[model samples]
Target chain A: METREMTCINCPLGCLLTVTKDNGKVTVTGNTCPRGEDYGIKEMTDPRRTVTSTVRVKNGSAVKVPVKTKTDIPKDKIFEVMDVIRKAEVKPPVHIGDIIVDDIAGTGVPLVATKDVE
Target chain B: MYCRETDVVIIGGGPAGLAAALAVKAAGVESVLILERDTQLGGILNQCIHNGFGLHTFKEELTGPEYAARFIKRVLDEKIEYMLETMVVDLKSDRTVVAMNRKEGLFSIKAGAVVLAMGCRERPRGALGIPGFRPAGIFTAGTAQRFVNVEGIMPGSEVVILGSGDIGLIMARRMTLEGAHVKLVAELMPYSGGLKRNIAQCLNDYNIPLKLSHTVVDIKGKERVEGVTIAEVDERLKPIPGTEEFYPCDTLLLSCGLIPENELSGSAGVALSPVTGGAVVDNTLETSIPGVFACGNVLHVHDLVDYVSEEAENAGRGAAEYVKGQKAGIVPEDDTVMEMKAGKGVRYTVPAKIRPATVKKDVLVRFRVDNNYKDVSIGVFYDGRLERSVKKRTVAPGEMEELRIRKEELDKYPEVKEITIGFVE
Candidate 1:
């Protein structure tokens, strides 16, 4: 069993949290709000974060309007996910929140809009 | 005058207003109206093409437009009435908003409670005290974003962002991808004012240089921005003499900071907090005025849109409760009051004053520090007398920290008249 001290990043409070793991089970404590609890579990069991960056665009003066995965992806697959996003090209007249990738790398994190581009 | 009478009237049809209206409906008060100045319901979010919102409440990453669409759809589904192209020119003391728009020359609405969510405005070059002749190339970050995202216009080929705030950082990456040569992102502060992720993804990933402890001392141009003089600053914030350098750029994008849109609130005769330059409110988010509530960017600059939604909902719920006669206003029972000051290394704390009745156990006292301090203890004092201390491994002035004193712990401090929060090494 191993123990870790972390801060919950879900809210502005930045609550000091403790997470303990034995075998494969995880336990989290010391969060003030519900969002903190969710963040703690995600941090302990399966940490995932939505990746946002730019992608190659077609037929536009500006290259990017910022794009991000719609869902959280596994911690390790971020670079692989970006490679795919960088290679893919979206035609102009894209509205904000238009889904680019439904399930990127099968991580279930859909690539979505960050800014509108036309 | 076409007067729309309602219990609560909200201004600015953004996510804040949408959330506020939804919260009002959830609280069992339905006579709510949201007035928008734009042709559509969504405000700035329509142009904010980036993702980074709706992570907490929705548990999914959504673009600005997508996030606003969710609430706007919900507001429509709930039958929340709103007016488009409605610009409120005058708000009266009796809670009436007088507006003039294209379709209608004049209209009025009498509201029992008002939620001001006008959001904020970006700081421009003039606000930064940069010595320069007025030129055509200088633009605020928001204007640049709108030009690029909405109108599909490239503001410039060479860009130098004046502030390392989120907007500036985001623009740096944007201009680069747009085939523009972005020279640098200059910031007056040593540390970035934007989120850590923004600094990483926007600048670092793009190899865009970030110049810290720097300032644009002078701007030189005739018809358009030709070049700018940059200088390094000392601890006192005065530009050092020999550290002056010049960078040639056709465009200067200022993302210095954001100011709360509090003109209407000021006109309403509401008390303002000098620290945040926003309306002061109790726990209920109600302004000093009997039935006026303020939230979102109009109240204070928020780091995340999620917090803005949460606060706007609080204001909406509070307004609903007030209109329903569910909440009774009263002078705090404990006549004793303590003036809370952000002692050394602290920027400011909200409310500024605390009453025993309004002080709750687990009170979330949010305050910012003046500098980054490692191994610091936040000390709470009662009128110069030490009460309690919470130790922190690391704390920064850029980030707001909240310290909680349980109701049980608060009960012990009976003689407390005023509380002061400060940091020490």
Candidate 2:
């Protein structure tokens, strides 16, 4: 049996959550919402996080265009995804929702631009 | 010298100014002009490339630029007039604005109403009063952010941030993502001044240590930042002796705080609230100078730009009403105004005065606390009588809270002389 306490990052409410696992059964308490419970369980099981970053832009009004993962990627792969983003570059006239990287870090999560660059 | 006249003139082109102009146009104001000192429409939002914006206004997470773009698109679509790279030098009590730009050497505009949306400025190291030699590597968190996110320049290899403000917390994660070692973030207050979500995603997830009740004691380096000395602060915020710890770093980023920019407001003879460091206004968001209105950071530092836009819209609408009233040859009747007083644990509230008669709808009184409290109830009193109380799970100084008082409710208390807001234990 093991127990872990963490702050739920689902939203700004930041509910304090305690998760306990016994015999492969998990119990989450101190959460105000279902999203908090889900966050606690996933944080304990396979922690994942959505990555927001900027990639180099070529001939754009901005030197860098902000990008983020379409969905949460595995927590352990954050650095790998960041490394790829750091080395990647995009051309001008990039539109929002444009995929900057496909299958980022083999996580099957695409990195999409958050803002348009012209 | 050139002279022009407009019904309403907005002093900035940032989120606040853009929203104000749009609102004025929507309110049926024909002549509205926005003057922006920056080369672009978006102000500080241009450098704030990180996400987590517009969740309230747009119902979706967005970057600063994305949020500003939404407003810019509307402004362009409406064909609102605006001048980039134009700076207003002076504003008079009569709504006379003296502005300058390269294209227009010097120009003056007389407006029926003016909205001050100059925004706020980051507190620099000089304001912190830390004993230090003039170093080259020191920069405010916002400046560093602009350099990295906008200019694609690396600030330093190792960074030590002072003050756990949102900007500082965001920079800690940003520098780390850019391959820089963030030693730690030191905050003077026992509790962090940043949003809880930022403390989680920006620092906790990254394993960046947040030292509460700690501050930078000294800065070491002559030409560049070689290191910084940090020490724990006592309850009085005085540095404790013999608790100094040194971290070798190339850069020292200060995210101490933000001050509302009100230089023009002062020149316009607007009465400012010492607590908010901004102009004092009534429920209509009109300053002491009747024709001038203020909102956004110029009125108070806001945690979210969404709120800035909302408040700017109110100011815009207020200015439009004032302009229309003036053109109609109608003088505003002096109505009974009630003063709003901040009680225990409450810092200050915007719109320090409330005129129930002029209020078209409910008035939102926004305020902040002096410290963090958990499971507390906020009480609103009308002339020493408890009117309403709201239970909040948690409240902190970093986040601004609001209590809406409906005019319909105020109508019941016609003889109300004062309203007080405070935290109930």
Candidate 3:
């Protein structure tokens, strides 16, 4: 059996979770929220995150409009994900909520503009 | 739809916005409007069911909603104009905000000065890299608080906490009182991030053990949270071997930390300070943008709600004062902003940019250290000369450190352009 201790990031309660694995079965204990189970398993296996940052713009008075990934992506693909966003550029007079990168890295998460760039 | 114009348009109807509204009223700005995304005026305070708030400003014990109500009631008494269920969809420097609601399908408000009091948001599991099976037993501290206090729902029978922040500490007792067997409140930090009073009242009062220098290393479950593993950590925060222990439970709550909600501010071309993850503001709480101001958790992660209220009032009044042409008219003196960096046991400081003499307000530098210490003094240096000093009140990396530089003391450094603050023997 393999066991591990983890902090449940599901809530402000920050429940300490105990994970015990026997053969192929996994058991999670110690959490006050329902999301802790999902958090723990994903954290142990394939971790992902929703990256939020800015992308360069062309012929725009403003430097950049802050953007974020609409969906979480695999942790290993963060740098590759950001690289695609950095290489991309757009024109000015763009409205807020404009999609900068759609289906980025096949995460199906669109990088949307947080503000207008004119 | 009714169209309106104001000198200042504040977002988020929480205590921060309410305090800002009152400050604008005090500054004689009649054309001020507050747009709240929530139907209730009190914001999240309405869901917080515990006490241990209002220590600095009120010198009395109060609950979250009660503390927020103080400002909300004042906003009503002041007759501050506000719109409920209004979500600001678009904000632009041209002084316009595209807001929408059920009552008002689509509307716009124009203002000269804008205050961002959107407050801070809880960092969720997705932010933390925890491997686990997708189940229904995980929740955030704020979400649990809402469920327990507002919806009267008991999340689980057995629980364990991961962070030792004030919220996590408070929830330890809250969950216990709600008839849950709380195993432990583990923190990666050596000391607690919550106030001293919370440690005694919340964890200690309930016989709940708080394990320091501990972290959750692993999790397990298929349908629900079946268990969690905790381990001691070394100086680098890497988990140490031979110290792992498994605790069985059905749920987990996360209170790691709160991040400032700056998507809107960052989008509006507002510069942010890495220390607090908020905006760089001058003494008047005005951002780099001439007519923009910020306060509350949106400005920085505050230790108390009282401080948030204080800053909101300052931001509100600053916007009002600027609209009235009474705020600081001097430019930043060409990047003459002071910088405060933590030393040996220090971490980060806020208000990343300090505009000298912009206002007569007493300057207080608030920061957090990197570790726990005894008998230390925080020193402020201007060009290698001692400028101000404050005695330590048991400085800990978990708790924020506040150092005051009186107006007169700051005035002494007439030629000082930049300053650095740190702690020394």
DockQ of each: 0.14, 0.60, 0.01
Better of 2 and 3 by lDDT: 2
lDDT of 1 at B49: 68
Chain B TM-score against the true chain B, each candidate = 0.91, 0.98, 0.93
Indicate the worst ten consecutive residues by lDDT in candidate 3 chain A.
Answer: A7-16
lDDT of each: 0.77, 0.91, 0.75
Task: Give the Å shift of residue B226 in candidate 2.
Answer: 0.8
lDDT of 3 at A17: 76
Give the runs in model 1 whose Cα sits over 4 Å from its true position: A1-118, B326-340, B353-362, B382-387, B405-416
- Model 2, B16-57: lDDT tens digits are 999999999999998999999998998888888777789789
- Ranking according to DockQ, highest score first: 2, 1, 3
Candidate 3 on B1-425: residue-level lDDT in tens?
Answer: 55667788998898789888899989888888899987678777666545545766687645565577677768888888898988988777666777898987888887879999998988898887777776778888888877775554679988989888878877787677556889999888777777655665467646799998898888778888998999998988889999999999998898889999988787678888776788887777878787889888888787777778877888888898778773445444444556545554666666555666464667666677777777687788776667667676457665566776566655677566666677754
**Root-mean-square deviation per candidate:** 6.3, 1.7, 18.4
> Per model, how many backbone clashes are there?
9, 0, 69
Which CAPRI quality tier does the interface of model 2 achieve?
medium
What does the lDDT read for residue B260 in candidate 3? 91
Cα error of candidate 1 at position A31, Å: 16
Model 1 docking tier (incorrect/acceptable/medium/high) = incorrect
Q: What is the lDDT of residue B42 in candidate 2?
A: 81
